[model samples]
Target: MKYYSTNAKAPLATLHEAVVKGLASDSGLYMPEYLYKLSADFFDSIQNLPFNEIAKIVATAFFGEDVEQKALDEIVDDTLQFDCPVVEVSDNIYSLELFHGPTLAFKDVGGRFMARLLQYFIRKEGKEEVNVLVATSGDTGSAVANGFLGVDGIHVYVLYPKGKVSKIQESQFTTLGKNITAIEVNGVFDDCQALVKKAFMDEELNRHMKLTSANSINVARFLPQSFYYFNAYARMKAAGKADNLVVCVPSGNFGNITAGLFGREMGLPIKRFIAANNANDVFFKYLQTGKYTPMASIQTIANAMDVGNPSNFARVYDMFDGDLQKIRSVVSGATYSDEQIRETMKSCFDSNGYILDPHGACGYRALEEGLTDGETGVFLETAHPAKFKETVESAIGAEVEIPERLAAFMRGEKKSVEMSADFDSFKNFLMTR
Candidate 1:
């Protein structure tokens, strides 16, 4: 399979080049020149195959002969070391638990897969060194940091909003010292994202450093996310309850929802998608008005979705050929305030004994608001509730137990440098590093 930039300027590239370049020279996300749809028989066959087998089939289809079968198998083994459990939260609502991985967040699938793929690519091309630049609001930094930690020939630099992320989220990135460096920006997530994008576009920087990205903008980051969507369908089929299903995703950068749409295009039996958002509701407004107007993002308890201008929305738009009607037909979007998120968390716990973090609660609220309309809606619980312990405990009047992974985080020492959001400051930091 060959990949081309959606901007139509860059030449078609192999999967290795697409993974390494991240964004195209024309500043577009890379997409396959052609998408190969999976047959219905293949979807039916997934129920019998192990998760790793299913991943290999999907990976080989997109990556072709670039990644060896043995290397691809190792990639799947390392990436999917957790379960994506679909727990019934009520009569009509279900919560897909996606926090069982090492970093206890859904980004683990994409981050880990990207790291392994990069390692394989570097080995094949005989590159001596590579640098991965990423920006995150919460879970992404830790997932990327942990995924690429101590990997030979690669270094990861993560930038996050200072004092905005949860304590645990901050610790996850800052605690890892070797080959992973964390920088705290004094602005919002958009500011951090802008710095990373600018670095990729800098010609001088590219000459001296091979700059890659682990953010959702990378095709590598988007591809592995399609696995869990198929996994969810497989689980439902095993229970003999397979039907038209709608997935409620707490979308910030819009990567997860875009991947789900990709799965639907690949023959997954999905009815629709709900793009749940916090106060920074640019996506919600775009779904309603067909015009994307970005503004300053507001800080909410669901800090991850606090992106005013999501980079992956460009991919979503490209998927629909800039046709608003078609986009609306396949995807629905809604926004919730901090108060609504808290209320939904309390109600879900009281009524169904499910503890949801603030981000997932936004998804539950979106489902409750009738956006899904009685469909078998599965709201994605993207992070462990312990990630937002204070909010969950105060709203539910109880404590959320920390997992062993997070308990270990408490003992790790945090190491990070604070910097202004100016581009010159970021450039200076990169030069010194």
Candidate 2:
């Protein structure tokens, strides 16, 4: 299927071009030309299939025209090595646990899927080395860095705000010394994201080396996220709790929630969506006032959602044809302060014996407040709480055990190149490399 630029200024691009280019020439995120809705029979029997099987059906719908059946199946199998299970957090409220992957964060699905898809295209076309530029507030760096680690003919550059990410998150990316390079930017996550966007738009940098982004701006990265939404729906359906199904996402760059929106378009039967935010509530404010105003991000315990200007907002706006009423009808927004996030985390653990990462806390609180009668809400538990050990411990007032996989990352020695968030500095660094 062809993909069009959200800006509508660029020519139509094939799946290959969309996947490799990452961003449209017009500096807008890519959107699929058409959405392939699932058949009614598929949804009826969806619960019987395994996670990867459900994903393959969805992946084929989105990619079958471009990718061969066998190859696409292989990619789906390789990418989803872990399951995102739906666990009960409370009555009529479930948590889609998405932290069971290698990096133990939600982006693992997109990160790993993008890595394999890019590698497939590179190998198929015999293309030269492709450089992946990803800016992470926290988990994205680790997820993308580790996803492309040691892959042949590809190098991943992870730019992250210095001293802003959790120590565990930092260790996950900075320690990987293979094809992954972590850049510690002396600025906020927004500045790091700006540097990436500028690098993509710079002609000199493009000429110096092929550049693409793994951020949600890339169709390859975010589109695969819809897989789990289908899987989550199937799980809910199996549990007979699919009625008035509401999915809440702890949104940051808005890629995660945008993917969910796409699933709804493909007829996933999601009743509606709630975008949960921390203090950096640009999207939240936009929902309230129907005005989008980007500002500098504010740091909170849920650092992953610390996006001041979510890049995927362009895709969301374009998807809804710039209609605020249409967007509002399908999606709602909620914001929480750090104090609220902490309180929700503590209260949930106290009552349900379920620990939530700070990001997930925002989603849980939103569902708790926003769910109407007869609605079953599923908030995405986007990351493992152990990723934020200190913060979780303080909130729950108990020791949090670090998973062995995360503990292994902590043991690896840190290695990173410190750079300013200035575009010139980033350009020179890339050119020099």
Candidate 3:
């Protein structure tokens, strides 16, 4: 499949080139040239199909032309070892529990898929060491780090804001030493993201060493995320609640929602979407006034959604052809403060006895206010609440049991490199490495 840059200036890239280059030469996010719509038969029998089957069908649409059927199926099977079950939280409302994977977050699917796909290409082309640069606020670092951990011929560098991520989130990435290196940037999530983008754009750095991003800006990383959307729809259809299905995503870099939008274009039977945001409400403001405005990020309990200038806004804008009204018609926006997030978490636990991570709280609360009668709402419970144990326990006045997976990470000692947010400093560090 041919992939084009959203910027429209860079040359079109093949699947291998797009996955390797990550960002286009024009500094635009790569998007597939065509979207393959699923057959009516697929949707008709979707309720009977398992998650792996649903994901394989969707993955085939995105990658079948470039990759062999056996390889693609293996990648899908390996990536989705766990299911994203849709559990009912209240009447007409459900939570798509996506934290059942190895990293205990929704990103595990994308992160693992990207890692395996990249390794496939590396082996195919006989390439030398490929460095993966990923910037994360919370869960993404751990997901990508653990996904690429100890994988031969690839090294992952996780750049995260210092003192901004949860302790558990930090431990997940920083504790892993093999092939995964954590860099603590002395700034916000946006700064770390900027460093990754700049490194991709730097001529000398790219020439010196092969650098690719594991962030959602990469086509491979974001496109596979569409798999879960199809899987979620299949589960909802099985439960006889597929009519007027509204999926709420807690927005950060906007990649997750963009992937869902791609699914919608490919005929995923989604009624609409809601992008829930924290205090950093740039996308919310854009939905309100039809003006795209970005600002500095604010530190909140939902740290993952704290991206102020989301990198994937380019893809979202390009996907809608920069039509604000059309984008608004399909997708709505909602924003909440830290206090509001806490209130939602506390209230949901008190009322439904369902614990929500701060990020998922934004999604659940958005559905609570946005869903109309007869519309089935499925909000993404993006991560395990135990990852944010302190905040969740304080909000609900109860202790959260740390999962054994998370406890293992906490048990490991942290090892990381500290760096400033300056692009030059980042560039120099990479050039030396």
Candidate 4:
């Protein structure tokens, strides 16, 4: 149950240290020392259990050594109140609808799970305060903000790129006035992420406040994402289509897909995976060439996948011992342009009466092109279509009715401080205010 830094420079840490610290002192992501594979009987009975029931077993397998059975049960129950159902989108391709939670995105599982787990740690240790810093290109801000809202002894600061996120995405976090503060960063997501990483490493900031990240870089945040993949497999199994199963995830910070890979390693019976990318295709290019080179990100309709230098890539590299052929055997890549995303969204709507948000469109298109015969592909519909109302409407030539939750959020008054993406400015703001 011990976690080690992917960089292999920091001391080995307990699950508590890894979750609370968020990032290593050496600026590396923390990963579990060893992954525990599930038993065959577990998978045999998984298809018959409820979503939360399946989650409890899987969560226990990963976190049981670190957390007590009763406490872990409560955490899994609190986190998985919502369901993720796999809906057939094409003949052999399905879309795992992961947007049924409060924030209507896949990250809700991680955000809520992390919030509960962190609060458990806080209450047990009598910590005065813990501040969560999260960077988002889109859905993560809302998911984290809503997840941590009003939690005792915790404050959340959501840093999102100005004008890059959808209005609904921005509103969901910025309007939450208590315990959650949204900062409109005058730069891209990479800048916001850099600021968080720097703040975690800065001695002055650490002295002033307990700093941890809710970004995928945090094991507490991303490891719970494995719950989503397991739930998807369970659902597929119930439908009697578990054989030759392939999961496709829309990759941004690479947390979602990496969690899926973890599930595969844990004997999830998944045949392979597809990391669908938008215009910011650094990971895709790396999968193609076996050389990872980070660059500045470009804006795309699938804004959530717009990360240039994914922090979780380090964990992915470490998980497979930096073996390219090993990664390629179970995982593949596909990149799409904004035009292609629009086209796929339109086509899905026209052909099947199914609406896809831009991010899911990339996943759907990738699965459509990549799935071979006798394989059933399940692409993650990571967010609700209504989240990107305007863009989706334009693409499908039909109106997207805003969900009640999103509509309420949009009506709330915005209340975030505008700040430059500079580390000094961010640090000073935190120290001064």
Per model, how many backbone clashes are there?
0, 0, 0, 0
lDDT per residue (tens digit) for residues 1-433 in model 1: 6888878898888888889988888888898776678877888777777676777777776676677788888889988877888888876677888998888999989999999899988988899788999999999999999999989999999999998999999989899899999999999999999999999898877887898999999999988998888888877667655576778899999999988888888788988888999999998899888889988878999998899999889888998999999999888888899999899999988988889999999888877775444467788999999988888899999989998889888679999989999998988778766
Write candidate 4's Cα lDDT for 53-142 as tens digits.
Answer: 888888887899988899999999998888898899889989999999999999999999999999999998898799999999999999
lDDT, candidates in the order shown: 0.87, 0.94, 0.94, 0.92
Tens digits of per-residue lDDT, candidate 2, 193-250, equal: 9999888899989999999999988898999999889999999999999989999999
Q: Which ten residues in a row have the lowest lDDT in candidate 4?
A: 53-62
Model 3 alpha-carbon drift over 4 Å, by segment: none
Q: Could you list the CA RMSD of all candidates, in the order they appear? A: 1.3, 0.7, 0.7, 0.8
Clashing pairs in 2: none
Ranking by lDDT: 3, 2, 4, 1
> Highest lDDT, which number?
3
RMSD of 3: 0.7
**TM agreement with the true structure for every prediction:** 0.97, 0.99, 0.99, 0.99
lDDT: worst 10-residue window of model 2: 28-37
